[model samples]
Target: MKQTMTNLKQLIRAGRGIVPAHTVIVNGNLVNVMTSEIYKADVAIYEDTIVAVGEVKDYIGEDTKVIDADNKYLVPGLIDGHIHSECSKLSITSFAKAVVPCGTTSMISDLDEYISVSGLEGLNEIFEEVKASPLKVFWGAPYKTPYTFPQSTVSYNFTKEVHENVQKWPECFGVWETVREAVTEEDENTLGAIVEASKNRLPVFGCAPMARGKELNGYLCSGVRLDHESYDHEEVVEKMRKGMHMLIRESSVTHFLKENIRAVTEVNPYLARRVSFCTDDVTATDVLEKGHLDNLVRLAIKEGVEPMTAIQMATINSAEAYRIDHLVGSISPGRIADILFVDDINTFNVEKVITNGKLVAENGRLSYELRAPKRSSVLTSQLKCKKTTKEDFEYKVDIKDGKAKVLSMNVKGPFVRKRRDVVLDVKDGIVQPDINKDVLMVSVLERFGRNGNKSLAFCSGWKLKKGAMASSAAPDDNNIIVMGADAEDMSIAVNHLIENGGGQVVVADGKVMEFLPLPVGGIASDLEPAEIARLENIINKAANELGCELPEPLMYMFFLPITAIPDYAITDVGPVDCIALDTFDPILELMEN
Candidate 1:
């Protein structure tokens, strides 16, 4: 509150000419996101707030540091409306170092990945780490925990006590996206939690992908004000028409901006105010190679979006969606001096970045040091699962006669979310995976030392003919998920992950091939971005060598256990029908042929 009063005084004093500004940018073309206009101006900064704009030569004091813009385009520092810091495979501090240089000054992060591992303790740890960073980080409480029946391995029951505790944190912006299946099912516990979060007037984030007509309306009626999963322009337009803020996302796993940005550029440009850009899930490799939110803005401009409009979507639109525009989203007075200098407006090549009145990045390199988060014993000891054997992953089918119908997760691609049922031949009175037909055994084992639960099922489209892949980074649960043609190789991979405290592992012919250990909560690693990227590349190369046909083999394997997506997902309990929010029998009775 004292900081608020101090800012108000600075704004009033600067406007009255009673005090000179601390620093000034002379002769610059400012991209005003609020007005969607570009005009030549001089910006004056008093401390961390932009105190004046438009010809402020008199406000410059002798003690102030002046930066000559030389008519370069000044844009508000980019903000990622939604992201998961853990997806970068780096700690929050390391993730900041990687993105700040790319001109991402602020981000709203969903720490569900960490929360799913350590509950509220994990969330608090992440919040403190982010608070110490140079970037502006906003928190979104994990909305869906224990997302499936029989409970996830690291499930935190979203009880009233936990919800109240989450609300007490000032950094928490809102409850993150709720699973569509829970909302559609009208789960009283989920609905009550939303009400509890809304008591503070925070916006609820939604996750209703492919929800149309009444289903979409039902989700919105539950107080969800924003969605980041809309994949097409039609979905974007429909959501915007219904008063939902659409966050067009371009992540490593999915690319929706090239097609969805057209919703504003061609269909209804005026509705662009209701849309924003987000990187829901991206890795360090993508950020270092392709850029961060700046990549989204450049792509939008190249796809025929007006320069100012694209900037607005990346800046003020995102801020307004989260009700934070008054703080850090524009080049206006009383806002934080989070500004960027772009050499080319059309290409969005950011030359320099400033956050909180300090020069954080210059020439695409971080000019400051980023400290890693202090590790806790609990965080470092995430793998507590007992040793596993081939029997744990075996699927014993009781066949009295011949063939039996089976249910399989038919993955067409990394992004497709439908399951298919197929009939397969049973051999030796037991159901066996037909690797010759591209059918491989998939399993999810409880890894958080809870109940020792495990489930088995068959999957297609993995295209692995010789080896098995396993990772402890499965979404929402952080369970050990592995798919393999040979049960021995699968056991070797899962046991390696268990012995290494949790990580991604690939095994072929009962031999360890490639491994990347993530000792931090079994989800994130303390490794630097370059090292993590190197390990990830090695894993991908091994997967390709093993004949894995998925576009993003690691990501595909990780997301297989996320029950929030449509159709079917495997959990520790069994195969879940996501739309119905219920578990179905893995074995199907064979009909007489």
Candidate 2:
């Protein structure tokens, strides 16, 4: 409180011309996001707040630091409206180190992936660690966990206890993407949580892909203010027309920003203010190779949006969507001194980054030190489960006949939203998968030390000629999900993950080929960003050799169990028809022939 009062007094004195400014940035073409104008101006800062803009010669003093922008573009530091830091496969400190130099000064992250394995205690630890970083990190409370009962091992139902706890946290900006089940089913617990967040004046982020007309209206009427899951230009324009903020997303798994930005340039350019850019999930390799939010801004410009408008989408527009424009999103009086120096507006190449009136990164290098926080013992021990055997992955047929019908998971592309029915020969009371027809066995085992529940089903589209792959980073639940043509290799892959605590593993011919261990909460690693990228590359290469066909094989494989997306997904309970929000039996009874 004392420090806040002192800062306020300092700002007042600097603004009233009674005191000299602590720093002054002179002779830069300021990209004013509020007015969508670019003009030569001088920005003066006192402590951590921008005290003045335009003419600030009177505020300069003997001790004030002056930085000549040299006729370059001075834009507000970029903000990622929605991201999952855990997806980077690095700790919060390392993740900050990787993106700060790319001009990303602030982010609103979802802890749902980490919370799925470690629970609320892990979430609090991550929140505190991010708070101590030089970059600004905001929180979005996880709304969907253990998505369905008996299917997911860890149950976080947004009860009264969870609601009260999240509301009291100062870092929480809103509730993260609410699932369709809660809205359609009108679950009292989830709806009550949404009401509580709304009463506290926090926005609710939602996920509704391919929803149109009445379905979209029902979702919007349920109090969801923002969406990042629109798949096409039509969906983007329609959602924006109905007053929903759309976050155009481009990430390792999917790329929709180019297509969605067309909605602004072709259909409704006036609605650009309601559109923003976000990398919902990115890997360390991608950040190092392609860049962070800077990549999104550059792509938007290349796609024909004006550079200034694209910058606004990445900065002020996102801030307004989250109701944080008053605190950030522009270079105005009383806002934090988060600024970026760009060589050219067309290229969006960030040369330097300043946050909170301090130089944090220059010339693609960080100026400050980043320290990884010590994790708790319980959170570190995330892969607590028994070893598996080939017998555990076997599926016994319930039919006494020669052949049985089964529902097989089909994957035409990276996204697993479609399934088909197949008939398999039943031999000796057991149904075996037919790899010749691209049908492979998939399983999810409980690893949270709860009841050792396991579910099995058949899937296509992996295109794996031979071998198996297993990962504990399954979306939403973080369970050990493994797929293989041979049951023995599947057992080897699952056991490898169990021994390594948690990670991605590839096995062929019952031998462990490659593995990347993620010890932090079973999803994140404490390793350096470069090393993580290197290890991931090796894992992907090994997976390619084993016949996996997807571009980012692990990323697509991890989301196969995400029941929130659409159509179908597999979980510990059974195969879920996501559109209907109910579980279905994997087996099908064949007609008498």
Candidate 3:
């Protein structure tokens, strides 16, 4: 059957829109975020798309279902241009069920989390599940991934031995190296992958620090078009000047750069049109604890952005950046019948939400069908860590008698530093850190099962109880990471995690107190948003009880391997000195010199 909208059928169709179903939204001020215009009108829907929007006297018909807006605001559907569908901490269907109630009608995801644990087939399966949702979810490929990113744990490709991997490489013409060199950009595969996406006439996203002037230009020269990693105003100006649409991001790893955005807004008001809002990665708890794209809209308004302008950034700017403005960014005919009922632009709140000409949420409560997605590749992907030796987690350091100096990177969320050194105590082969001294060991194990790929480095933060504490952002289906105090509790956590397949867990006193079983890609769950939040509290309290303080325990868990931002990030490869833009050999070397 032809797509109800041509696009949906060609991609992932969830049935179709029932046409000519009479529905009148009367007595509302419709704000067209695209043209930055607002007018009093009564909108009419004839199926899944809006038929007309103006005065209702001209839209009268028998058997029409009239919704008295009671003079509420009717704007276009809120669309998040870039997101990690995995961030919902729910399966596609469960995710859709949660966000639909928040006035989020459509979302575009990088699918990085799924791909990291599954593969292309896994991504395709997710697309199929997202297809069956009430909200619209579009798929975009990721630009950069952690060393853990390639999904080798599932079906990743980096070898010339694999026919499928080799087939995808001839598509490359220039240097498109790994995400490792966002500065030098030496990999040709990156360009080839993006060009392949462009060849398919799809909007692909680019990932780079955007601080390297020449590298930024080269990335644009490749097929990648949009960028969501502008960390500074200087970078944003350069990108906009070079005609790149910048996605102002507030991810779990990076929040909106306050001074940077403020400075940009002060200098050039016109640049606002080129800027859009995106949440790269967030947990399900943050969804309830904070909000979705709505948070970005609120922040922009508070940061001196005109409320209408903020709406334009999140709605029109986003749609236009990805070339979908005509479809969901504004109140127009032939567009999906998605609208947000807001009482005020400032201090935005979801009063009601209508999607596909149907009311699914009223005052943040679900009013329609929302269920778990049918998963096709849940635990099918696995990496045999049978090769991982216990020695892989152990390291030896020579102590020069009385005192020893060790190198470390203080963990302050996602940002890393290149600071040369610090001092520590050396005992029992491992260099022990003084907890009162505020120093600790941070490590990233190659759960990809590669021998000698484990990275161990020192970082400051996490004051655990009487045991050892650890956390892993490992995106492997078999990835079971334990975070807690003491060896016995850690063992208990690991056993519990293995029992549950794989997911994030927190342990204490030899018991599996709490865990979020992510059997699906080992990144997200098939649970409700509220359920994720409830279990997440156990983690937060565990952190607090042990004195592991930062902010949100799980919310702050995103920084272990973010290479783009400046943080002493450790990966399966090693401790990356980001500011220096190089890997530290035996991390202690940095501290000694």
Candidate 4:
């Protein structure tokens, strides 16, 4: 209360010109997001809050720091409406360094993957890192863990008690994604979390991809008002018409923005008022080479969206979605002084970034040093599985030396999978993978050292002709998932991850070709973004050398274990028909155990 009163008094004095402002930006064309206007103006910042936005020569005293923008466009700092920092495989501090220079000042993250591995006890460790960094992190308390019931294994389940505790934390602003499948099925945890978020007056983010009519209605009745999983422009228009705040996602592998933005460019331009942008799950390689939300703005503008609307989508629209518009999303009085100077609105090239009234980055580089956090002991010891062997990944069949017909999970893409029936040669009671048929062996092993559970299934879309790829950064469960044509290479990949605590690895002919160490919680690395990107490029290169044609193979494989999406998924339990929400036998014929 005392701090608020003092701040109010200081703001009054600064605005009235009785006291000098800490910083002043002159001769700038301010991109007013709230009013959708760009006009020549000067901004006055008192401490870290904007005090005035018009002619501010009176506020420029002897101690005031003056910056000559020279008629550059002054825009608000970019905001990522939805992101998973853990998906970048970079620690909190490292992730900040990657995006802050790209003019990103804020990010709303659920941190669901990290919580699934470290549990609620490790929340404070992440918060400690968030405090020491320049980026502002808005956390969303996830509704549940594992993403599906009986489909995957996770160390911690998001109970009502956990939700109750996290909702009271200052960093937690709202409920994270409410899975459409879970809500429509009346999952107790999800429904109860929504109720608690409403009681606290917090927004409920949603996830409903490819839903329509009755299914979408049923999910919306649960009070989820925001969605980020629209697959096309029609889906985006349908959700926007139903009063859903749509977030057009353009991640490293998923390129939905080109199609989804058509909802505003071609269909209804007014619907963009409720639209925002997010990079749901991106890699370090994408962030280092391509700009963060700034890239999205450029794409939106090129797609025929007005420049102001594109900037608004990257800024104010997201802040309004989370009800934090009063604190950010615009360069208005009483808001934090996070402003960006760009010479070209069409290209969206960032020249200078002023966050909290301090110049932190310029010309795509951070001027000030960003120190990374020390590795925490709590997150470094997450991988606890035993060393795997060739026998662990075997898909045994009843036939002694004949061909066997089995059900295989065929990847249509990264998000959709279908059950494919294929015939494979049976050699000595083992169903051998057919490299000619593009049928490869895929398995998920429980890595928590609790159950040591392991399951096997066949996959075909990977197209790995000779080698194997494995990763512990799989979504929701964060378990070890390996896919390969040869069992020996599969074993080598899994054991390599186990030996290094956790990470992504590719092995060919029983030799590790590339590895990216995720020593923190077996999901994130403490290294800088450049180093992470270097390892990711080499890993993709190794996968390409092994005959995999998919772009971002490691990223595509990471989503295979998540049962929240549609069609089918494979976990440590077995192959699951996600639509039916049940496990199915891989063998088509009934066989004796």
TM-scores vs. true structure, each candidate: 0.95, 0.95, 0.84, 0.97
- On a 0 to 1 TM-score scale, where does candidate 4 land against the true structure? 0.97
Clashing pairs in 4: none
Model 2: per-residue Cα lDDT over 131-227, one tens digit each:
6776787778866566553246762334645876777677788888776567777876668768888788888888888878998888888899998
lDDT (tens digit, per residue) of candidate 4 on 81-149:
999989999988889888988989999988888788888766678888887776888899998887864
Clashes of each: 0, 0, 13, 0
Q: Candidate 3, which segments miss by more than 4 Å at Cα?
A: 1-21, 55-63, 143-155, 158-183, 210-212, 374-392, 398-404, 417-420, 448-453, 469-492, 509-513, 578-583, 587-593
Model 1 compared with the native: what TM-score? Answer: 0.95
Candidate 1 residue pairs in backbone clash:
none
The ten-residue window of minimal lDDT in model 1 covers 148-157
lDDT of 1 at 474: 80
Arranged by lDDT, best first: 4, 2, 1, 3
Model 2: which residue pairs collide? none
What would the per-residue lDDT of candidate 1 be over residues 237-274, giving only the tens digit for each residue? Answer: 99889998889999997889988988888898899888
> What value of lDDT does candidate 1 attain over all alpha carbons?
0.82
